[model samples]
Target chain A: MKFKAFLTDNGISLLEKRFLPALDKMGKICHLYLTRDHAFFLHNLLNGDGIQSIAQFRKEALFDDYRISSQNEDRIAFAVDLSLLHRALRSVVTIYAEFGADGGAAAVPPSNRLQIKLVKKLPPHSQQAMPFLTFETKGYKSAVIQDVPISKPLSRTDVLELQAALDSAQDLPQTLVQVPDMNQLQTFVDRMKHVGDPISMSISKCGDLHLQISTTLITLGAEFRKLLVIGEKAQVPAEDRNLTAQSRSERAILRGDAMSVQVSVKHFSKSLQCHLAKPDCAFYGIAPQGACLTVIFQFFIPGTHQTDKSISLHCRLPVLDPGSG
Target chain B: MSSEVDAESADLECELDNVQGMVDALSSVRWKRHQDAVIELSEHGIVLVVEESSCVQAKVYLQKELFVRYEYSAQARVRFGVSLGLFVDSLNTFSRPAHSSTIEIRYPGPDMQLLLRSVDSLDACIYAEIRTRIPETISWDYNFEPAGSTPLSFTVKSAALKEAIDDLEWPGSSIQVSLQPAPPVVTFRGEGHGDLQIDFMYYANTDLLTAFHCDREESHRYKYKFLRATTSNIPSSVIKENRGSKLTIGRGGMLKVQHLVSVAKQSNSHSHADSAGYLQPSRIAYIEFFVKPEVDDDNAND
Candidate 1:
């Protein structure tokens, strides 16, 4: 396997300030998947019990002059500690900040650019060759290089399994509804954690979501209605469609049955950490079999409706048995 | 915020519009986990008192005047016991990121629970009902009296006061708080591995000491643990909005620390009933703590 890329100034910032830091909060180690089109950080996607996070970035969006080649169609996947990668990018960003006035063109000088590559190194205390994701930043009078050790490249079969997991994770529910404001959700979850271990999240067909946490003493809940549903309206069963035929507001209030799934409050709390990403809006959906609660964070162009497709984050919170709590 | 609503609300409901302020007030007194607190409702307002041992006690006074809507329907005072930590956490949920929260809090909920409901979410609502039990007998009710005719009081910045107590870190010992009349200064001395003395200059450092008054020089010793507990969790939001906290030497060397919590959002602070005040003092809620001093031979002079 081979991979090399020069990270653009904007790319360095996006990683240093947003994605890497976000991943750092989610977990200690993450899978770095480099392909022809994008670089993805996959967390807890395999051997999971914790939160599963996927942060994807288009190649040109983060790096220029990108190249990757492998025996298996130019794709490489390996696990690396997030803190190490975060430090590497942060150091370069700080150095560039000091010499910010040195650039005049559409980008920084070639010598000042940050480059990352996959390399094998022999440590001073060990004889075995170890794979490293190397970061090199060369300035006019200074050059800084860091080699962060990473797990061995995935085998062909491992790659295929990861591909299948990615496909399954990307599958969205037929109906997607925007969640309550993160601040409210944050406080709601805070209250719920004290009431019970697992919470029941119910989303009705008429765009109403209710989260209830119960204990022997009391049952606490927050109910959100008239939320905006995103994209295509999923096909509804004939009986449900007929039920939604009343006036919109009345129908929303009248609907009582909803698709509900029980999820661990610990996992729910971890997913709330996505607020650090500063998503413009977030949507909540339930995976098939009530297996996972999926949260998609949508980032939009600051002043317009244009979705900034360069970056994306998806979190899957595993569901817990209803009887567990 | 309208007179019509207030006139109507006073007859039978106890609702409030500032959930953030209530949370901030409650969080300041939540020094320990699972602390039982007494909530008393009267014609004047709500009083929440949390006591640690018989030596340390904290109280939050949510005057009816501070509430957006205050209604006292019960013919007699009502009291209930709740977990301070849980109450604060539950109040937090009603707050929204972009807007201040409005909530209606009522006692004697259908099942004798404390009911809290959010009123600000356009098409959404959040509510929490916490189980309330009968108030247990407390050992003491400390009614603070003046140490001297002038009350021997001084006001200092809340954040600075908290920092000073935190710096005196001599564990399992006593913190001696002394006032000097000659120079108008206050000193906190902690004795352990090495002696640490933190002095506040009332005459020179007028900025830190907003006000200073002492009839005579006096000194007192208090448990280091109890002294620190009083200022342990002054909320960050409180530090930003208010000016300072007041420290008074009460009867028998009892220390009283008072902090003003701005319950009214600054931009729209025009009370339904207009009034003039310092830093909108009338609109602010009050938090007070009475700490009984450790009797190290009455004259705790170094």
Candidate 2:
């Protein structure tokens, strides 16, 4: 298996500064799935709730130039510690900052590509060996190589099951609402984070969103109006598009017909921390009957037309049992 | 002794219009745990000294100019040891920006409790009393004067310093800092999983350093953990003021970092006779951290 990519400084910065930090908060280890067209950082997020968050960096969105050659046609996956990779990227960025971008030393020739190589190395006197991901950049006379060890990839059954879940989730009737900005959403969630457990969120057909938390003593909530509704054309399948169109006309009379989801306040707030990286636009997707909720953040490289780079955090919250609580 | 005790009973009381100015300064040294901080109150100002492990000490001084009313009895000074955490929390209770709070601090005598009362504009008041004990007088003579004719001194933009430090690869337990005069280079070196060296040359990047002076080449290795006590404060300091902070290194390997606290303008103005004539641009608080270099026997000769 071989994978090499010429990643731009901006692309690397987004992953190091924005993408990885959010993943670090969710889980320790993640499977980095590298295909011909994309690099996926898949985290199970076993935050005790068994939620999964996938950060998909399309090849066009990540690398200025790249290539991936593997024996099999399927994507090659490997597990790596998110924190370790973050540190490695930080080190690489630091080197670039200190020594001019061309690599500070005069002996090494300048190269545009920050090469990443995965190699299996057997150290001296070691009985077992594992693969290590090495980040190397050569400039003028200076060169830096940061090697981070990787763990065995997740089981094929687990990967397939996760993919199936994502695929099945797309067909669920979702109420998509455009979040005005991350700051406002973060503030609303932050205030409710400490109020109580199992925050209840409802998005009306008229584009009004309400977040509320109630305890035995107090019930606190906030209402946000005029939230933009994401049309069904983009997300709904072609056959179901007509059905949604028909329902839209009928739902106009029933303004309060809203989709609602109840999720743990602690887990909900932890997911909001990812917004600190500052995504350009965010969308909230709630599954019907309060099954699950998804937050999709869109990020783009500055001065670039590539807008496909995005991260979606999927939270699996149990439908609040009426008698259990 | 009886007259002295009577005089102490009538000691001075301190009052300020805003508690945020005091809380912001104390939060910088909140890293120390279970350590008693001595608060010295006088007519001139209030001084808070926090000592940790007998090796590192931090002092935050709020001058009388920053306070609205400063009064003192006939006594010279009143010093007491209080829990820094509790004191800081009491001040922080009224730290909201929207509400204006007036803080009154009073000490009756040696064994009397320290009373801190905060009253907000909404007629809400919070009263907190902390038991005060006689502060242990430890004579710590820190000579600000340099041992050599010209000590290593430089003023760099806080943003640049913070960025440079954040960018350094902290690979080892200690970081080696080198300041040289000939080439005017400031380099930091660390070793752990790998050897990492970062250098800043005056000629290369002139914008980062405003002033650089060194008589001879001086390099010292300090415990990275100790130096980290001030790392988190750098970003906040730079955000407050564009003007950089000053760093001074003495021959004894002691490092002094001075940060000017940014004071928010008072929205509610009281035209008192005392502060009416004082037309200072703004109140400024200074936080100084003094870190003693760890002795590395291997590098002692070098």
DockQ, candidate no. 2: 0.01
* Proportion of native contacts present in model 1: 0.58
Query: For candidate 2, what is the DockQ-based docking class?
Result: incorrect
DockQ for model 1 equals 0.32
Candidate 1 local lDDT, A62-123, one digit each (tens): 99999899998899999999998898777766655544555543445556677899999998
- The lDDT of model 2 is 0.64
- What are the chain B TM-scores of all models? 0.88, 0.83
RMSD of each: 6.2, 17.0
Residues A1-325 of candidate 2 have per-residue lDDT tens digits of 7767766766787788788887787668887887788787776632235455667776766676677776555556788998999899787666655445454434233453577777777756898777888887754456688888897544566556555654564443455666765664565466445445787666555555555555542334444445677644222223322222223322432443566667777666766766755666666656655566666666655676556434334334333532110
TM-score of every model?
0.80, 0.48
True contacts kept of 2: 0.00
> What RMSD value applies to candidate 1?
6.2
Candidate 1 chain A TM-score vs. reference chain A: 0.87
Clashing pairs in 2: A105-A141, A105-A142, A106-A141, A107-A141, A108-A140, A108-A141
Give Cα-based local distance difference scores for all models.
0.77, 0.64
